[model samples]
Target: MEFSWLETRWARPFYLAFVFCLALGLLQTIKLYLRRQRLLRDLRAFPTPPTHWFLGHQKFIQDDNMEKLEEIIEKYPRAFPFWIGPFQAFFYIYDPDYAKTFLSRTDPKSQYLQKFLPPLIGKGLLALDGPKWFQHRCLLTPGFHFNILKAYIEVMAHSVKTMLDKWEKICSTQDTSLEVYEHINLMSLDIIMKCAFSKETNCQTNSTHDPYVKAIFELSKIIFHRLYSFLYHSDIIFKLSPQGYRFQKLSRVLNQYTDAIIQERKKSLQAGVKQNNTQKRKYQDFLDIVLSAKDENGSSFSDTDVHSEVSMFLLGGHDSLAASISWILYCLALNPEHQERCREEVRGILGDGCSITWDQLDEMSYTTMCIKETCRLIPAVPSIFRDLSKPLTFPDGCTLPAGITVVLSIWGLHHNPAVWKNPKVFDPLRFSQENSDQRHPYAYLPFSAGSRNCIGQQFAMVQLKVTIALILLHFRVTPDPTRPPTFSSHFILKPKNGMYLQLKKLSEC
Candidate 1:
């Protein structure tokens, strides 16, 4: 009876299909094993921490543990192989010389970022490479010119003042410490909306339930989760997962919001609203610049292109700035002397005026030093990644082949004792012109270095100076001991819990 069942035509086809599937699986396994072996052979020169055979180094290195990272950095010296799984690893570069060598190359960004971020940011400057990147960069460069940035100072000041007013109310009404990250995040969003979208949004004063704001936060969490969870790395698997579905829904929300704004701007432009050259130069925002921009071929950015850049700016502009400004405040709170010194410098520059000017921004030398030191200690974007496009040799004669992934640990570089004495100390003087000149140029990379550096760094600096100076002028910030901040390194380095601080209203302002 069994022999007769096996002889059936349908049974023969089913058996063949099963055998084929088995063969395919075996082939994939063999291929992966060979690739892993090749990678191990290539990376044999670099030191690496002990890794599990199956789990790799995921157990040893975690996002929360800075001490363990420091130990690894010390043991590995210049660079090390950080294995994510049996078949995946990155050549982690922390040495200034290694960073300088790799960053100067025309290497593309990591393949993982290219795979993951395009779904959200849609091949914006942060995601694009080579010719397309060059074209978009040229077109958008004028949007951040000094003249354009100068016009944004007033808008930034107004946003900061609104935040201060809220802080004043809270300090007067209650005796409790305030979690400042949320407030600063909202304020930064408010500034980005006015300056980038040319729209005024009372994000700081309003509730945080707005769809755009909520979507950004949730989507970031999902993307960061996907990056670390190896199984979710596959588009097919991720799309079928619950988080993936949520990502699609939230992405639509963000796109719809931006598309609406772009359409409104287009309608206004079509209606022939005109401005004189001087007026346009003084008042044009990022939206205006990109909308009217034309390339060498007299081509304007497609709606998709504009949408991508806007989404990139909206997320990059506000979230990172909020982290930076909040951390700067936290550092200053911990070191009262530095805080007082920065406060006095701002006072000297502004006198009784609360409004900051473009010229006065330069005069806050001490404050700038504090800001730099804060960024060095707690960089907003802690790690930068690149995929080598060609074989590269480092200063120490170490070599990595093309197609290898390299991670530049800005946190490790900043904390490396070889680069800075007493790396953990909050010393603003470390950034003084004399001391800064003595250090390696790539040793401190808050906005990264090279052509792929943060495009909005100048704009971020202006906002930082304006917000910090104004806040210092009005309120004296003190750390809350009961709620000391814990560090979390997700997409951005931020307080794990929240940045809680006591704000005492100052009579000076």
Candidate 2:
């Protein structure tokens, strides 16, 4: 009876449909298996640690274990690969030869960064790619020229003085160990606000904090938390979660604050208060310069684009500079011998004066070497991310296909025994002219290298030189032995606990 029913007109069409669906499913399964097999075969050439066949290496990296991975890199020097599941793989490149080749090509940023940051940073130069990124880079390059950075030295010095004033007040009352990172963070925020937007955020002066600063700080925490949550990488899942809601709220606060600042600047420029023909004017600030820039297509940034770029600069500048400055201080505190040498160099140049002029900053050569060594040992950004836009062949002739994500571990590169001698020691003289000449150009990448390097290198170097020169003048900093900082892996390099320093007045010294 069933066979006879299948032979009928209605049954025949139903039978045909059923067979068609079955064949389609079988074909899809075959294609998936073939693709998986090919990915597995392609990954076999690279070296990987012991991993779960089902879970792959995902189980080992459930948390941030970059400190552990540094050990593994020593064993697998060519390139270390990690499998996410059965097929997906990532390469952590620690060798300079590999880093140089990869960075020389303008591959788009790692997919992981693009996924997490655009929500916070939008299409800013840090996150933008292709024609858009190039355009924005060109537009903003002029704002960071030497003349503009030189004019900002006064602003940086003022912010540093404000920080020192607070420190002095505390030291005068009682000699106590102070947590300096918090103070440095606020000071960096204040400096960036003044230098980038020509506004005094008063983060250093006001006891009542700025809401924008608080929101920015909290947002960074939220964003970093979301980035490591692999299950929440999906947009729909993340949006439905609690971190997502908090991220949205914090982002709104940040956007509102930046928008207000942008509008205020625009109004001031329109009213001609920002620039005047009759009065002698100072250099144009970053905000004014960015507002006046246009692309090759004769297009100016839209209000939204302007907001993104400003927010990018604000967020990028604040935390990274703060961390770098705090670590520089911490390194000096631990190595008092180096600290005194730098102080003597500064005293030789400035003669008990706290203020640093642009030309005077260049004369602090030993101090600059110490800063370079500090950066090499503990880079502000421990590792940077990249994605392969095309197949890449390393110096060893090992080839990686397109779409492979990589971590260029600045931490590993600095510590590699092949490149550095006595890598663990605090030797600032390694950066002297003769020693530096013997090193590979790509070996020390504090600000990274190649065409896509940090745009604020000049600004950051100036800020560091000024703050360091001033602090050494006023205070004798020593480490708190009880509370030594352990390096922690975060989006930016950070201390596991905190940085506590004993600040003795120079007169007491």
lDDT of 1 by residue, 83-154 (tens): 877888888888999989988988988999888776567878888889989999999999999999999999
Q: Could you tell me how far off, in angstroms, the CA of residue 382 lies in candidate 2 after the best superposition?
A: 1.5
In angstroms, how far off is 155's CA in candidate 1? 0.2
Give the Cα-based TM-score of candidate 1 against the true structure. 0.95
lDDT of 2 by residue, 105-189 (tens): 9999988888777656777888888888889999999989999889889888888888888888889966779988878888998
- List candidate 1 stretches off by more than 4 Å: 1-7, 60-63, 274-282
CA lDDT of each candidate? 0.86, 0.82
TM-score, every prediction: 0.95, 0.89
Mark the 10 consecutive residues where model 2 has the least summed lDDT: 274-283
Clashing residue pairs in candidate 2, if any?
A: none
